[model samples]
Target: MNLFAALPEKERLIAERFDSLIQDIKPLNSKQLAFLPRDIQRLSALLTAERSSLKAGYMNNAVMLSAYTRYFMRWNLFRLTSLFAGMDTTAFDFLKDGDYCLDIGSGPLTVPIALYLARPELRGKKLNWYCMDTSQNALALGENFFLSCAARLQTEEGEPAWRIVRVKGEMGTRIKNKVSFVSCANMFNELYWDTHNPLEKEAKKYAALLLSYTVPQKAVFVVEPGIPRAARFVSLLRSALIRSGMSILAPCPHEGACPMEGKKGGKWCHFILDTESAPKNLQALSEKAGLPKDRAALSFVFASSSPAHQSSSKPAGGKTAGKSAQGASRQHIRICSDPIVLPHGKTGRYACAHWGLTLVTGHRIKDTLSGDLLYADLSAQDIQALPVDRKSGAKIVNV
Candidate 1:
């Protein structure tokens, strides 16, 4: 179900609140927004620049906040909230009502706001939320935005939805609470660039830190931009967590080493959220920003200290079995990259199956999309020896 389906009335109310919030911010006007395109272009350059060359001074500050509030907020809030909405709530089924949550780099409390909107069950529940950030201004602003959202979403006489703690400091400074849920969204890339630390070192450090704050059956979620570099970094982070004994919870059907690692620039794994039918305010913002309102993309990893209490096996027909998890009728593979349409009339799709990276090709594979959990029959030949042809070892199945 869609996020707003739980409380239909709140959809309009939330959209109205977004309009009011933006209007209330005096400097965030059409003229300011018009100028934001330039800032957005500059910010994009800064983000994709070489790590050592970055001006750490301008990374996170009042200036950046102004740009975000005026221009980036519309896209970021829309994208992130859509991502949160599309998440599998089963990943959070283990969390209890009163469990604590810690959101690192909680800029404007994006993840928390999305969580509440996506899971209305969280409303009227006493969940403690701790927001950690290095910028006091960001924390203050986030607090205001979060409270406004909560006030609008909460009904009269209902239990307070959350008990929030705003902590201003570098994230991962210490493990304050045994958090039941932890989210780090679009924060690691900045950490990597600002600190000049290798992705592996940073991933290892944060993996340990996140684990320290998490109890069994709890989860840690990380999301980055959908770019190839960011996707690869997330893959590295996921591998580190897996080696550290954490279990894959969402997205992936197997915990094997990511199939995209050894390959050099073949395909990257990421998810897409269709945002064409978003709320009125969001659509208006997209139109104003000269950006497409149809799709939002991101790469994310969700891992838990305990294995998901569900069947790992793929279902009957399109099931593609993997070597990692046994006792399944069908094998499963995660499509890591977009399909390549060969000039010879067959489509080529790169996938991560139980046997490792497999080049899936066939006449029936034309409709296969990236990020799909595909199933096929590969028992006839070894996955490693399969030829890159339409008649490749496996035939596409129902999945």
Candidate 2:
């Protein structure tokens, strides 16, 4: 039986809303939806105010709190709803019926909510769901709404169903200090730009934030907006975690240079018009798993010197994590391919998307806590192209 088969009817209902949101927005085909769910404007605004808030004190700043609150929840939702619908099963499949989880930038608790709703088996465990974000108001609203909405399931047969704490702070840093799994969704580029494009100091803060929150853990899942850079971002983060010595359990389904990153560049993110209009890459697969290629492509720039694993585990102190603290910090890259089948009678192989590539990295270290290789840093190798036409077999593996 599938793991999601035993969830509550209500939970399944809410999850369907997420699905509805995807269909309604139509981010893939719709020109308008393309660059949207725009959390950047909100991000920019929040960053500006956050700088101000610190001047006096966080206390009694209703205005700052208001903005902070909205920013946090909206950002969380913007980052993850798509992810929950896209992913089939993940590395954290081993989570107990109930366990502690950290949803970094947990847009409205998309990951945690979906996981709980989709898998009701986790109903009784003490789910100390940590919701960390820089928007305090966002966290407050999100937490309150969640508490109210989820109150019914808080307990079953006299046991606490879920205990969530929404903390308003930046991701990429420590919160509560420990966790089983940490989910960073749709905030990569934003945080990446923080160092320079968005604001250099913000960038460093984000990096430090992640490093602070990441190192000591069992499993950490890093998901980006399914844009051109999303895959690359995840790849780099995956490499870093692995280098830090974290065992990677369920990683993204894609194993290649994403389809969007050709010389011409490609679109970012995908949409679901309905169950009928899903991306072919997703439907044609053995399982409608992972962020599909037919979805908008995500691009990533590589760092040649250090492996993803090694770089990822680099401590916040600008220190590279040790093999003990950062298990996967060694240089071991993972190659991913979006396997496609060609037609016999037709001229070339049969794949829907225009182009695709595989993702590779360096560094391999067992996760310090879980003994998996996702606990450290990563260095990128390359995004080699797949040979096309019947004359060329997919050579994505060799690169």
Best by TM-score: 1
lDDT of 2: 0.39
Candidate 1 has a TM-score of: 0.80
Clashes of 2: 94
TM-score of each: 0.80, 0.49
Q: For model 1, how does the per-residue alpha-carbon lDDT over 304-350 read when each residue is reduced to its tens digit?
A: 77775323222223423333223334456766556667566767677
Model 1 lDDT, full chain set:
0.65
lDDT of each: 0.65, 0.39
Model 1 worst lDDT window (10 residues): 310-319
Lowest lDDT block of 10, candidate 2: 364-373
lDDT of 2 by residue, 1-399 (tens): 010112246554443344333333222344422322243233344444443334323322543343333333333332243333332333234455445677776644556655554444555556678887665544554555555445545553443467778776665455654566566655565556334342333433443445454334345555544444444445445445444444433222123333422122532222211123322322332122221222222222211121232233221222222232223233222222232333452121111111232221113211111101121132222212223333333322211
Model 2 regions more than 4 Å off? 1-9, 16-99, 152-159, 172-174, 194-211, 214-217, 252-393, 396-399
Q: Alpha-carbon error at 307 in model 1, in Å?
A: 1.1
